[model samples]
Target: MPAPNAAAVPVTADHGSATWRLIKAESKLCLRDKVAPLWGVGFPLIVLIILGAIPTLREPVEGGGGLTYFDFYVPVLILFNLAILATAALPITLAGYRESGVLRRLRTTPIGPARVLTAQLVASFAIALVAMILFLAVAGLGFGVDLPRNPFGFAVAWLLAAAALLSIGLLITALAPGRGPASAIGTVLFFPLMFFAGLWVPIPQMPPVLQTISYYTPLGAGMRAFQDAYQGNFPSILPLVILTAYAAGCSLIAVRWFRWE
Candidate 1:
């Protein structure tokens, strides 16, 4: 027989291959769920197209400091896409997996529970990122909204915000006992986050009190950081700190409370 260490190498390689297969399978599942992509990608693009059709929205506005209303909404739509993925789609799928015994069944395999969870998360994250890129392309080519000027800064801020939002998604899954509850809670949280992020109202135009309050919300702070990067400025330290805290804190809570069943 070959040496034990040599035998172990095949096992490790096999495990890695298994993980990739799992990620691909999860990705396929996401794709099959047409509604998820509809809300996560299509809806935002449609809204942007509709908004772009308005002549006034394309022109510079006093409230927007010479940037058109369309310019301000581009980042908001990107964030909105991310939010829908993290809050609505991710939690529901994970919770469904848990409820249907898929996760529990994986416990008996070489892959292990954590690796399976990681695969699912990675798949979902990839989908969200793809949706964001599509949004950027459409915004740039169709609407003439400038891409984020500071690409590196914008990327960092986006990754941090995605982590924070995804952590919140996991936390929601951990607490919700079933798919219905998970979706319900995610939907409830989604609207408020959108409002504070200035989905319906521009952050600059919000009352001073609401603006101050929005600064503390994850999407709110994230929108500010994203907007700043859109205009070629480094994001403020406070919003970065808030994003970090939400990511770290919510991840800890999720891990601590997650149920395999």
Candidate 2:
């Protein structure tokens, strides 16, 4: 009777069965969609290969504590994977669903638009997790990069980073009018975010001013936490706090503004 913004049916044992189906369907769609796989997984994996083959990148970074360039890149590329999935893959698909009135139509169904949103988030998280493990495997076995020294800390940081990035994607979807604008917004956000994550220049090598700015950025803080894990320590409190703030703030804004049509 109402629209996409309507309150969802309360969850129950049977309702959760529908939830599983939606997530499974979305996972299939995520795989079939060429854009996400190509950029999120394929491109990063390809770059890892090329970077690994370069002998010079194995040299110790100028100010990267004790890490080599290649070692530094392993985590950065992992960040690349998450960024692509969150900014490009997640927002584009959801905006397309809205533009095509798929979300609007869901209001009349037992599984409402909110459930579809949950499914999309689950699917994106699954893909990003796979890509993360794959990248770690390739970098460790193929390139001889060391695994994260603090494995548990690394995982915590990664999951928090994913939550924050996914929330940003949702915010983009909320603000963009259509699929075109969503893609445009995602692309616009991608490069600069990666830059602050130390894609082009290692954070240790950045000028003091830029490094200061990077500390506050979402990916930058995530990278800082990742580096801590890489170095065999738990992430410091400041970066964790910053990441949590971003995740909470962006999710609140996205939930408020998101429209089904």
Candidate 3:
């Protein structure tokens, strides 16, 4: 009888290692893409400058108990930047990769599709984290924004927001048919969702009907949670609950509907 073919045995460990290697490669490609860094970091900083320049936002509070508008707005700005970057970049890049057969080509390798997707998510989160830190630094040093009283609370809020937005982005990537359609849908979704986020206008100033509507939107709830952190107030637990539910629901939907092609 022929000698047992030891080499023929499937090496699951090798597959796991190869999957991670492919993930790293995909992350590098994403980082090298010029637009990702710009939108992720540049546009948000511009908004920070505009917020700092406003005379009303710069004025110090009389009672000294509350932060100025600039201080109030900085955390919201950071959250907004994270949401926009993750949602916009993930869908577009994933769709483009799928359309171009980059994801498909990986099927022939030891790397699995899920690993590739996870890599992209991780890469985006890493970039967003860096952008957020830089934004805080600039807001504090350049614009005189105050640090949050409860740093742990602030960190928790940021992580929750990232989880919620990243889930939505993944859902878009999995469900949207093609690059063009994904881009079109993302474009339509981003601005309207962001407007309710209180980035462009304060939520209190919005009409009663709109206020009620905004309460249900992810961006709005996220902004409220973030605002509470900035002002050193306790965040509403309800919004965090809502965010967790949304993330769970979106992730489930994405997994069920994801298309490799």
Residue-pair clashes per candidate:
0, 0, 0
lDDT of 1 by residue, 1-261 (tens): 878688555555645688788888888888897656777778877887888889988889775567898888888888888788778888888888888987778767787645655666787678778788988898899878888889988998899898888888878877777799999999999999999999999887899999999999999989988987988898888899999999899877887777778
Global CA lDDT computed for model 1: 0.83
Rate residue 202 of model 3 by lDDT.
74
Model 3 per-residue lDDT at 258: 74
Q: Which model is ahead, 1 or 2, in terms of TM-score?
A: 2
List per-prediction Cα lDDT, in the order shown.
Answer: 0.83, 0.86, 0.77
Taking the tens digit of each residue's C-alpha lDDT, what string does model 3 give over 1-261? 655997687787855676566667767887788556778778888888887988998887666466676776776688778777756778888888789887678667765545666777777787788888888889888987777776777788777778788778888888776788777777788887787887677788799988888877777778878777766777789778877887788877776777778
Each prediction's TM-score versus the true structure: 0.89, 0.89, 0.88
- For model 2, how does the per-residue alpha-carbon lDDT over 110-169 read when each residue is reduced to its tens digit? 875456667877888887887899999999898788999999999999998998888888
Model 3 pairs whose backbones collide: none
- Candidate 1 minimal-lDDT segment of 10 residues: 7-16
TM-score-better candidate, 1 vs 3: 1
- Residue 61 of model 1 has an lDDT of 75
Error of 2 at 32 (Å): 2.2
- Candidate 3's C-alpha runs over 4 A off are 1-3, 10-19, 54-56, 60-66, 107-113
Which candidate number would show the highest lDDT if scored against the true structure?
2
